[model samples]
Target: MRHVYGWLLLTPAAILLIAFTHFPTLATVYESLFSKGSTIRPSRFTGFSNYESMMEDPVFWKVLTNNFWFAVGTIPLSVGLAIAMALLVNRTLPGRSLLRLAYFTPTILPMIAVANIWLFFYSPDIGLIDQILGSFGIAGHNWLGDPDTVLPAIILMTVWKEAGFFMIFYLAALQHFPEELEEAATLEGASRWYYFRRVVFPLLMPTTLFVLINAVLNSFKLVDHLFVLTKGGPNNASNLLLYYIYENAFSYFDTNYAATLTVVLLVILAVLALAQFFFLDRRIHYR
Candidate 1:
């Protein structure tokens, strides 16, 4: 009777998962295997043509490079800033609450709101960044408008929004670290930097690994700000895989090929995830 009740309790969630997530995933895989023109008609089984086309598509390779660069730009900046912020906030500083709230404000702010605010900062002439540069007798080109500056602009926004969130994770890990370890090091007259590097950092390895995986995933998934700030321009410089997929599916009405591209992105994410589970999971040592 208890087993029956347990099954009944789990049934609704299982049904919902199958109806929405699992079923749609299977459907997409099926659709990706099919061939269809970019028309309003149904698609037919096209077997590997789309995959082969993707291999030859220069734009596909370009966008993949952009996504890779995005991850590279955001991951270290955000995670390192988070660790620095955590180290600051974990201290005995006064007005820490105010500092924390300021750091975390962008995390709760809507992506559109943050992007709009950043856009104003990146604007030429009257924009704050430009105004400051102009005052210094340095010319300021449009931050999001220039091909060379667009990706960096987006990367900067992403780090600001994400660092605070990752900081909280570091704070929790810091709390779990034993005070006795630090005290022992202090008694030995170990330098602050040496003690932290040898003791504290190794203890926080698990948390750092978690943050790295999360930062990579978020870098690929969250590009909404880029949509408003750069729109994958000027000339596909900021066009990451997900945004490009969105443009192909909705803007150009290429649902069939869009599905194929989405599957490719999924494969990339899956590889990242599997790497974490295999490598990071093994590397976390217990004290």
Candidate 2:
């Protein structure tokens, strides 16, 4: 009777998951195996043709590489900044509430709003960045138009927006830490850096693991900023994998190819998630 009741309670959530997540994922997989249908022709089973095409597609490779670099650039910097900010505001400092609020303001803003705000910052000649440079006798350059700078500019904006969010988790974890640990460290005459490195850091490992996973997921999933700022423009220089998938699905009206890209994306995410769990699960010291 207890088991039946438990399942009855779980049924709603299970149904929602299957309907929204599982069904769409399976449908995408099925679609990837077929060809894009039109009035002149119909979708036919093409087996691995789409996959073959994806392998040969230069734009696909370019975007995948961009995604890889984007993840690498954002994840560590954001996580490190989050930890640092959490440590800073966790102290008994003046106007701490205001500081925390300021740090978190970017996180609460809608992504579109954030993008729009940065759009102004990245604008050529008359923009904030260019204006600062202009005052220094430096010529203004198009930050978003240049292929070399576009991805890095987007990465900087992403780190600014994400650090605050990750900081919240770290701050929460810090608050729950036992005061006794700090007392003991003080008694032992351990330096602040040493105490943090040896004691506090190990204790924060679990939080770090969680934050790392989330940061990685966010890096790949974010596209709203790209939509507002670059549109994957200037010769697709700043394009990431998910945006490329969007371009194929909607802009080019190639849903089958989009499905293929989606499947690949799903596989990459799953593998990375599993790898993180497998490796970090061992080191995490759960309280």
What's the TM-score of every candidate structure?
A: 0.93, 0.93
Query: What's the residue-level lDDT of 103 in candidate 2?
Result: 92
lDDT of each residue in 190-219, candidate 1, tens digit only: 999998789878888888988888888887
Candidate 1 local lDDT, residue 182: 76
Clashing pairs for predicted structure model 1, backbone only: 35-46
Q: lDDT per prediction? A: 0.85, 0.92
Clash-forming residue pairs, model 2: none
- Count of steric clashes across candidates, in order: 1, 0
Q: Which sections of candidate 2 miss by over 4 Å? A: 1-11, 276-287
Runs in model 1 with CA error above 4 Å? 37-42, 279-287
Native-vs-model 1 lDDT? 0.85
| Quality of model 2 by C-alpha lDDT | 0.92
